[model samples]
Target: NFILFKTISSCLFFFFFFRSYGGKILVFPFDGSHWVNMEVLLQALHSRGHNITVVRNSKSWYIKENSTYYNIITVPVERGIDQEFITNTTSGIMEFERGALPLTSFLHLTVTIFHIMIEVHKIFIDFVLAMLNDPDFLKMLKYSNFDLVLTDPSWGGGAIFAKYLNLPLVYNVRWILAKEAHFSLAPSPVSHIPITGTGYTDKMTFLQRVKNMMFYLLAQIHYYLMITQTYQQLCEKTLGPNIDFNELSLSADLWLMRVDFVFEYPRPTMPNFVYMGGFQCTPAKPLPQHLEDFVQSSGEHGVILMSMGTFVSALPADMTNEIAAAFAKLPQKVIWRHKGDRPANLGNNTLLVDWMPQNDLLGHPKMKLFVAHGGTNGLQEALYHGIPVVGIPLFFDQYDNLMRLKERGGAQILTLSTVDKENNFLKAVEEVLNEPSYRMNMQRLSRLHRDQPMKPLDNALFWMEFVMRHKGAAHLRTESYRMPWYSYYSVDVGLFLFGVFLLVVTTVFILMRCLYRTVCKPKVKQE
Candidate 1:
């Protein structure tokens, strides 16, 4: 009886302690697949008794109007990066990848993607303006007394909003504006650190290094012309003339990076950047009875899982038939998440579902291989579960993500242009299955990923709460972002030193000439 009473008392004490200390966090999230991971962080924070208020748009693609974990504040907008936009953009990219020459394809693809991104940013800027210009919205936000703003820096409005509210800012980030988050927050040397979309690794040949620099410069130009100039105008008009958008974008109190060294190549990172790769991953829960029964029925042959992430629901009909034919040849039972018309060549061995429990399936004991489009979240999950991958890179950073795994020897890459030609898909799948090294290397990565001292999600939560406790994590942030480009790189200091050395040399030369004249004049007069 006494022990029972003690247990009850402890439970009550913790319950009250958590209730009293819970923070009020305001979330401004990016929609689509980015929301998928951001929602994971929100759920964790909600479990810890935090009060989460999510600011979403009326045209939001993935963020629902209602959720169990967070309250929604919907901002009405006419148009956004909705389903139609994504589908059309993806279709155009596919057309380019499948037909154009390599150089023409790259140039066209870059311009198209840049144009789409600019449109998205312009919409977000208008969204921010709508929120700021409304008096009632401003009053409500100010009265809420939020502790910090948690946001994804893929869009700039969140940072701008946080600055306007005078609240601390934290980012659930992998990309910031037009490039990888590290490029904004860390010292990125172009010689080693490969730019996104380049499909080059850290160890680059001289020609590759030159291409890497060109890519980096292109990204910088895109950011400056498309993002910085536009956002800077908005910042000045809304916040104050003194506000610099680039600095505001980098001035977050903490950065919860969505990658770790297990997946990412070695590079310099900032103190405020905390890697929480695979934070969304957990031990697989029990499968539904029907799903379990289907798995057990596979007998000696294990199951293969395939998904193309949130977007790209289905491929072109011919491409679909090609993939279906390859799966028909595989001995392993396959579960593929697909939409659109059923493939003509789909075998009885393959099951096509509109959706599947991807993580749970990946974690299953009988799971053998993952056929994926190489999204970051899916790749991290594959690493966590030790599943070898056959990556069919479609667009965006998909090729680069798969390249990282291929470099580590755990995955194979089949480009969209070649996925349907010459029996490539079937041969690649067979190669991974027949080879022992693929599974061995992947399992090795899984062990290393799981060997962290603290769970990635818990680490993320602690830092978030740490920011709340401390009001902000300014000490962890570097003031280098506030410096001018020349000042940050010490170009000005180098030039100053160079000028001083030249002055000393000039003065010494003048003095030597005078001394020579004095001595020689006396000698000449005497002669």
Candidate 2:
């Protein structure tokens, strides 16, 4: 067994080795969640001799500025308005006065989509035009012919660049492709596949399925009716109208979606849609001395690590105080990532820091529970470490994410709005900490996640390099992308079947009437 294992490992290594002959790869990562995962993959590819150049707007803050293997080119665009609006809205989810929109409301969802599309379209068009307007930058890109263009599908600029430069384009998604991307590339029937922001699962009730279908149709109809023409015009103005940005995007050579069966529900995905959900996660390193000592000193009671991710670092004062008070009563020590002053009445057992190494803390054996805002990045880390979660979901798929974890039996959720309730927060923490089943379930999942044949980084790197070597992996492109909407959904098939049924019923009714007129009328007259 040992000799056979060694032989197989050697062959796999050499396979990727020969395929590792590098190429110049261009990456366009915009969103924060995307940046975290894409950076890891980019670094891995860089180590494999690939030259990476990242093109991004000023709104992004997480891009590594000083890197030996990769280069960064910042595109100048008007940032303050859209960037400020997005930041404020995202932060407002946990703030009481801001009155964040509820995820369950269709109006809220519609408005959110409309707002995002308007802002994103503006940003995309402005960035492209600004870059095109710069002679030096345009000359630089024209001279440096990149081999592959990797992009987050949220931004259409990547598709524009690939089309203009005639480069092989690959999409890297930080979230599951259940949105518009799936509509084109995969089967997203509302019967089973849950909507991205909605909290429904694959085993949805009949009415829940209907609601899911409504959300899907509304989004699709809204896109085609409101945004399509304007987006086409933007493309025509910036890049030539000759190339359809939608078509160019749908023609992507490969798609790397941030999803895995361990974290997501089992669903059918296309051949090219590779799942590398936890690619950003790595084996936790030793914590800083102070943090390590804090956890060690917690004794048998263990520790709880709380963080709300980058965008939502601070909660409202009232909620913060409530959290502080709750932690004060608990025996377990809490290490919270807080930026400003400590909450009033903070307990001796709790410690606050400007930033905590979340993954490292979660990996600690004494870590008991994760109090989080339920962002994908944080959730994946918790799952990787096999720690049960106490989720306080605020907005934007956080609720849905936590609900899924709850279904998996490893998490318990509480809405941020209820933080002020007496003992609610404390009880949630206590229940998860005291329950053995949650811990057992999480450990089982952790084993499944870790016991994969290959690490996520390797899987991502292999697929990325494979696309580069195969010149886009054109054979992997499913016919789904090219199929028309009606055809793809089998809408035509349904209509055809309905038509045949209607025709047969009508013929039978006509024959019955004819028989009545031909024989029944004569019989009645004779009688």
Candidate 3:
């Protein structure tokens, strides 16, 4: 009887696993934050018995391997220009903040953006060459027969590699789409869709729209000057001649963007573009006893969690003191994730630690507000838990994210450039806490965000499988991708109509002049 039961269990396991047709899934992720976002989805895929392989950079976070389902192939690449530029540029931006001056003018901003794009192109070229230089890796990839490739859309190397391998490509954007990517995938009217750094929304004033258009045009110029030739060279070297990365990316089978209307403004989307925001979010676990006790002791004032995420952990001493002073005055208990020495002015209501379970803490019933650097992951988690925020955005897309939250009325921004940092921070904190409207708006959005018919992860899984099963789901692709720019925008049709109008006006004017000369001038002729 024991043998019979064991045989039955073994047969059932084989029946489920073998019948499902698990395939080899290859992932290409670029940065630390991107890797963190991909881990959740990768792990889920592995658990379903698919073999997952990752082409990873040495600097990225670790991915634990399993003998049965996971493998990691590390590629050694130097991040030379990008590292130095980012460090120097962000430091310069901070120095201006300390001096209480405007950080950048339009010209400076455009020049800086162009420099970054050029540096990024250099780094991406090196990445592609590194993989191509390794013969063993190339051979492995060629023979592995991957069913689908999930890649970062921001990194053009992945698109080149996917085209070379002749696999169906799926883009997994860890953040909101960059302007160019969004434009290629769907129609984005400049009047409504705000660029990542501009902080505008769907409703735009005329001047704002003009600014948006300038930003868009500048981005196009930057791409042409900095990215186009270099990207084409890399593609030619690896995947044969005349293969355009932009064209290949437009042909990608699916685009899974990490955004939803809950946090993003409403915009036109295509059939192939999927909104899989909050895929990394999960039901929060119970906080450990010590943390729970710390929060519960705060009573009515409750607790607030502060984190700058993994990238920007360091803060200037003066700014640190200013923040500590505000925390010192608040009745609410503060839990701060800090890397440097603890601030000297920390009050009894504050606790400083090197690490934090941020999601768990935010989900606590006693949790009241969040002090965030406005990273997308943290913001999404905070929103999912229905916590309001006092946002202090420093760089990158933080400004835009914070602005969106303020537009939604769930957050208030207090930058370091404010005249009185301590006072502004305190006031912002008090306003969010004292006002019932902020929390009420947060609750409403949170409910809408959570009330989806299917969870984001499940939705992603379904579509991923759908693509694999259908062998790229080519039927869903838009005809716009195949059309020329002039055809897609009806430029030629507009030109033809204008020409016809001009011809009709010319003919009418000529006839009118003829009538004047032949009849109206008869009396003068006779005289």
Return the top candidate by lDDT: 1
Stretches of candidate 3 exceeding 4 Å from the true structure: 1-19, 61-69, 80-89, 97-100, 103-106, 174-180, 419-422, 482-484, 504-527
lDDT of 2 by residue, 345-459 (tens): 9999999888777878888889999998888888988999999999987766787888878999999988765767867898998899998999999988888888888888788
lDDT of 2 at 291: 88
Which residue ranges in model 1 land beyond 4 Å of their true spot?
1-19
Kindly indicate the candidate among 1 and 3 with the higher lDDT.
1
Estimate the TM-score of every prediction: 0.97, 0.88, 0.89
lDDT computed for candidate 3: 0.78
**What value of lDDT does candidate 1 attain over all alpha carbons?**
0.92
Clashes of 3: 0
- For all candidates in order, the CA lDDT equals 0.92, 0.78, 0.78
Q: Candidate 1: lDDT of 52? A: 99
Mind giving the per-residue lDDT tens digits that candidate 1 earns over 336-441? 8998799998998888888788899999999999999999999999999999999999888899999999999999999889999999999999999989999999
